[model samples]
Target: MNQFNRQHIGKRIAALRAAHGDSLRQAAARTGVSHTTVGRLEAGQFGTSLNSTLRKIAEGYGVTVEYLLTGRDPQHDFESSLRRLPPEERNRLYFASPVTRIRMLLQFLMAEYPAEFPLDRLAARLGMSPESLRRLVEGCDDRQFTPEEVRRLGEQLAKVTSIPLHWFLSGDSGELAAAIPPEMLGAYVRLIKKAAEAGVRPDLLEMAIDLLILKHREMPAGSQNGRRGG
Candidate 1:
């Protein structure tokens, strides 16, 4: 890629990393790479060795190297490769890959919906036994999900929770207005619930307001109440 394109890619990488709540240090810890290297990679300050850098990032983000490199669909090819391995070995590599985040989220959802969508039912959907699904969810920190599998899992999760698939796949939480902070989350939940009762989508305008509140919280104490010119 040209320098401009590379820089834009770096920015995208940074945005994704930030959105995932990861820091250069966390990525370094996971990838056995240095923090400085990650910082440089995210800034497009390094050239060449781009392939290796992209590989590390793809693995870290549970994306395909091809996706990182060319923004092409790499899910099918990666998933096909994953399925060819022996079951146990595949399990090991899958858990160790970067897409393990999806596994963690699945586990979180299972816990969050224990009564309504129990483990057995979820396993059936994934074409796995309860024990296997349990293992998959429990060991997600060590597992890597290919992008296709992640997309499939996101779709399944949407079906189970009555949420939209794009929300999960694209990492947009429509309920952020009411689902972010635990403190005032109940208030927003009630608002959304009221909207549901009224048969209207809770206006995302409320969510935009909530985001501004969150942004204010992120500011320094001195800046918190200070008005700034646009």
Candidate 2:
């Protein structure tokens, strides 16, 4: 709507939900997001949300998420798409449609390796075909999976990336601390929390820290001691 903002987008989501005759709790139940989060999205209080969350919201609102985000159907005008919308959201221009962050770690990791990558193993773990898994990580956003399925997806992705489950679930970077060995977890979390508070993109910060760790591990012992002392 006005100025492509989060607040306006939130207003749209609220309007669409109300027009659909679904209360916050009902929408949350149908969408698999918590009611509190649904309220936050309606209030424009959310930041870059996860794509899985958006898919659930799209299902709750009865529109393909692409049409919802850009106000135009993939195949036709916005009006034509509304012919497919659940009657209530037609021309309700105020639905919150902020751009969401598809889980980036999955894409990054998927590309980092050679072609011999173990897609089948990951797919078997998630109970999906490799094709379906590729489409999902590539941001097809075509379906609203159940919360349990989403959790399993997160768990599997977390294992592959060695990141925390919360990162996969919510896009929160603080979860990077969980990847640390238990002996260092408390200190790492606290330090990373401070870095996160500085308004850096926490994911990028995590990558930089990861590279530093690898470099540290590979350094000669004398140089490592010298650098540490310096």
Candidate 3:
């Protein structure tokens, strides 16, 4: 009913159509909607009141209306069970399997740099052949990269994209990582890692860093020694 729900439903419809190997025209024909209407729906321009239209589109894809609206297959009890777990436990389970990890990483990268990293460009950056990269991106969960290859790719990405190397490696703390520029992310990561290794509490370190920055800012103008009347 809201904008967010409309956009979410539109994206699900588009993804389902793509998965079914249907073009806009084909999907429109199947749903008995005009191609222009199908395009508008896919673009998230459809009003939320079009329940009949939504049902028709869902039927065209041979999927239930629930799946189209929620991006969940109603038949999958395992998925429902996973969502009921605690956040930490859910993340652990999600990333425990190598296939899931690979898929997550690919999805993350695609979402972050959709225009910048096409399959071939991303493959080249990772030092993988185009076909190999395509297979990995296309859900070849069994395809695994060596530790060394991952390290090399991470390092290269850190240098080139200004995204932190740890993001490429661990893929955690995305919001925090995104806030820091690539030029500073390496240093930020090193500082955090060093603090963690030394058993320093993160909150204490954050407070100390904030205070240090404030102190620097409050220093007298043109005072290199940061002392009064120096």
Candidate 4:
């Protein structure tokens, strides 16, 4: 029995197939299902438990299994909330595009201690050429990322920089700062206090300015935000 509603799944699969210009035969070949079975599936006549086959269809179309099944944008409904925000708030959220966020963290790290973080060593460790790393950083400039990519990159960068992931993905930085753990909040507060005592203003206005340069390439309303991985 199909635990998931079959009609919606079939409709979604059919839509994706059509969008990709794939015939039923083509999808059947890719998924190893018979052409008739593919056609039936597209018509909501049957369902399957073959996750690998489902994944093949999803990957071929660059969508997540959840999106494929429900015809919804990925991100657990956060993408929907994005549309409800005002234009400036939406712009601020988009400003922290994955690439831009990662580059900002990297630039801050390197500038704070050039000798401690060797660019060559870091590049080699990541198996990326220095030029490639440079390009990756520069790519943030005037660039945009899909929501899936943004979420993935935000998680990865958060792990690397020890920053809370929410800080990067949160629709608002002010609200995100308030949500940090108490211990983490104490650390930041203390750091700010120390900086003030030392006559060093720990202003991150420049970082915000850099983030502002990111061009928002958000998907249109009602468009699916695709996903990667299982």
The local distance difference test score of each candidate is 0.57, 0.56, 0.61, 0.56
Q: What is the C-alpha lDDT profile of model 2 across 29-145, one tens digit per residue?
A: 888989889898777776466456766786666654443444433223322433676533322211111111223444543454323135675577567899887787776652456
Residues 1-230 of candidate 3: C-alpha lDDT, one tens digit per residue:
45247778888988888888889898888888777888888888985547778878866766656566666542243335456777555434422333344444555555554554567767786777988767766766443666676567667544433444554555332444344433334455567668879999868977765665456556565662444334
Runs of candidate 4 exceeding 4 Å displacement: 28-37, 43-49, 75-77, 94-230
Regions of model 1 farther than 4 Å from truth: 1-4, 76-230
Candidate order by decreasing TM-score: 4, 3, 2, 1
For model 1, the run of ten residues with the poorest summed lDDT: 90-99
Q: Model 1: per-residue lDDT, tens digit, 24-140? A: 888787666578887887777775777677667766666644344444432443345457867544433321332353464466546544543478877886666787678777663
| Superposed model 2: Cα runs more than 4 Å off | 1-4, 75-230
Q: Cα RMSDs of all predictions?
A: 20.1, 20.1, 16.8, 19.4
Total clashing residue pairs per candidate?
6, 5, 1, 0
The alpha-carbon lDDT assigned to residue 87 of candidate 3 equals 59
Choose the strongest candidate by lDDT.
3
True lDDT of residue 61, candidate 3: 67
Colliding pairs, model 4? none
Candidate 4 TM-score versus the reference: 0.37
lDDT of 3 at 219: 57
